[model samples]
Target: MSTFFSDWYYLSIRSIKQIWRPLLALIPSLFIPIFFFVVNSSSLDAFSKVPGFPPSITYRDFIAPTALFTAVFFSSGNAGIELVQDISNGYFKKLLIMPISRLTIILGRLTEVAVQAVMQGTIVVVLLLLVGVRIQTGVLGLLAIFAMLMIFAMAWSCVSMISALRTQNARLVQSLFVVVFPFLYLTTSQAPMPLLPPTFRLIASYNPVTYIIEGVRALVLTGWGNPAIWQGFLVATTLFVIMVTLTLGSFKKALR
Candidate 1:
């Protein structure tokens, strides 16, 4: 047990360092979300006053989660890219042959994602605040947002890592990630659910990201007692379990 944890600790440290070592690679994850936030918030500033939109919240406040999440989701892909790089450079196989337990490698990479999520969330939060966004749920709500995204990032990264493990193609893995990002806009991102077109609303209903974003929107604009608040955490937790199971299964196959 001690060995397992110690191995996780060391491996996690290594994985965490690899992410920070590339400044250029990390810049887009940091800037793109802020750019998204600034553009969307400004262009749609008038929409917050539109009927059926949530009251007492600007478009900037309503969309903060999407921006924060953009940072987290995009950065999570780096884990898979790094894993593929390790495989290509022969480092991954070396780790596989080491005395450390194999599962630690995945867990270590997840730790790095979790750390990156928290860091990215913090930066985005600070930037949002600088531009006058406030969380209705206050400090506690902000902390919960961080915790949720950190878990979500770890869970989401598993898919990317699995993709890398299967194709060993960084471009394919990244391309798929980019393709799926538009799904975020399909949700209640630009306007409240009531203001959305019926067809789009129906689509958003089945989208788990809708619930996650609503949960975050609740934290930002409505505070607790909003039933939708717990929905995001539930979805994130469920995804974490499913994705981790698949990742472990995939990891086993990669060994053979």
Candidate 2:
């Protein structure tokens, strides 16, 4: 088991080296969301006054978690694009020809991607604080926030890798956000579920992102616990299982 872990660790380092440059290419991705946060943070007062939401929380605090999560989501999803690129370049084939366990190859790549996800989340957190978003949960609350983001990042990275494994297409990996971003926006990004349009309210209730927003809000704000934390946890767990299963199966078939 130790040997297995060591091999996976080394392979993860290898993947990091291979993918670092392309990952750096994504520095430009933060600008748009930061711009959104600025524009929306300023408009949040009017929006909160627009109705239905509890009056105590500022719109900046309300929408901050979604922006943080978006950073993780995009970073994790894009981190896996190199997996498809490596496969196309026959790097995966070379790894397969080596004596290492196949699972290690996947796990190593995933570990590297997951680390990147946490970095992505941290960057957003820093940005949020820079723009005056505060987490009143103190030390414990801050820990919880980071823990949740990292767990979500791990789960999300696996899903991204699964997408790459299934299609082996960089375009498909890139396009995953097209589907995810719209859902995220339509959900609780702007307000609580009650303030959303009735159609969007129903959809947001079902959205996994809703749970994340709720969980984060519950931690950051003083008294806004939505029972949806369990739902987010469940969705993250389910996606992890489904993604890892499919990715391993695809890896197996690719080797065969």
Candidate 3:
């Protein structure tokens, strides 16, 4: 146990040191959401008044959580990209021969991703507050939102890691975000469910991102105690487990 933790710590620090470049690359992830927040709030201000929209929340408030999730989903691709670089440069090969556990290598990278996600989530929260979006869930809700973001980030990182380990190609790992963007539009990111077309609504119902958005939305627009919050937690947790299992399998394959 001690050896595993020590390996995790060493790899985590290496990840942290090298993460700044990826964080810089991901700056657009933070700004694009804020940009959309302004545009959606301005253009859709009246849309909230339409029947079926949740009462008492501005469009800005409604969309803030969605924006945060967007940043998270996009920024998470960096983990795989970093892993690919390590492989391409032969650092990963060197690590494989070390006495550390393979799982720690993956966990270390994920730990850094979680930290970055928390930071990005914090920036989004601060920006949302600056723009007049209030958190109905207060301090505890803020913590819950951060926790959820980390879970989501970790799960997405696992997906990214799988690609990195399998392909060992930076370009391919980076391009995974292309696959992620469509899900944002298909989910309830920009509007509520009732406003969506029947087909889109059906798709969104099955999209796990939908539950994640709803969960974060509950913390920001409603309260942490809402069933939607727990539902989102359950969905994110399940996804995390499945993704981690796949990532471990991939890591094992990479070891050979």
Candidate 4:
């Protein structure tokens, strides 16, 4: 058990060091969400006062989760790109021959992603607080919010890892954001579900990002009483399990 944890720790540290530059590159990922939050809140501030809108919650509070989610979604792709680089440069091949468990290698990379997610989420939360967004659930809710972001990041990273392992192509892995961006808009990012156009509301209902955004919003705007919080957690966990299984399968195939 000690050996397993030791390997996991070392590999995670090494991956963090190797990917520091790419992590630095993700600064823009963090900024874009903040910028979106600012512009979106500024434009929609008055909408918060609408009769159906949740009482006392500003547009900033309502949209803060989306901004955090955007940062997490974009940042999660970096691990896969880094993995693809390792494959292209023959580093992955060397690791395959080592006595280390294959799962640890992937977990190590994912740990780095989780760390990045926490940092990115923290920055977003801090910025949101600075701009007058307060969490109704208080500090505990803030912690839960961060935990959800990390889980979301890990799940999304697994998807990217699956792509990297299967294609060994950095370009393909990088293009994932293009695929993810549409989901962002299709969900309840910009406004409440009822406020959305009928067509958009229908689509957002089926979108997992909708649940995630709603869940996080519950923590910020409502509290644990909101059913959306548990639903979002379930969706995120389902995504994590499915993607991690696929990623492990892809990693196994790469070994063959």
Q: TM-score-based ranking, best first?
A: 3, 1, 4, 2
Q: Rate the local accuracy (lDDT) of all candidates.
A: 0.84, 0.72, 0.85, 0.84
Q: Could you tell me how far off, in angstroms, the CA of residue 86 lies in candidate 4 after the best superposition?
A: 0.6
Q: Once superposed on the true structure, which residue ranges of model 4 sit more than 4 Å away at CA?
A: 22-24, 49-51
Task: Report the C-alpha lDDT of model 2 over 8-37, residue by residue, as the tens digit.
Answer: 989889877754676556675565567777
- Displacement of residue 197 (Cα, Å) in model 4 is 2.4
Per-model TM values vs. the true structure:
0.94, 0.87, 0.95, 0.93
lDDT of 2 at 245: 67
- Better structure of 1 and 2 per lDDT: 1
Compared with the true structure, what per-residue lDDT tens digits does model 3 show for residues 1-256? 9999999999999887776864467677788877888788899899889899888878878888988887777667778888888888899999989988888988889888887788777888888888788888899998888888788888988887899998887888888878887878889998899989999999999998899999999888877568989998898889889998898789766776
Predicted candidate 1 versus true structure: per-residue lDDT over 203-255, tens digit per residue = 99888778778888788878799988788899889998998888778766566
CA deviation > 4 Å runs, candidate 3: none
How far is 89's C-alpha from truth in model 2 (Å)? 2.0
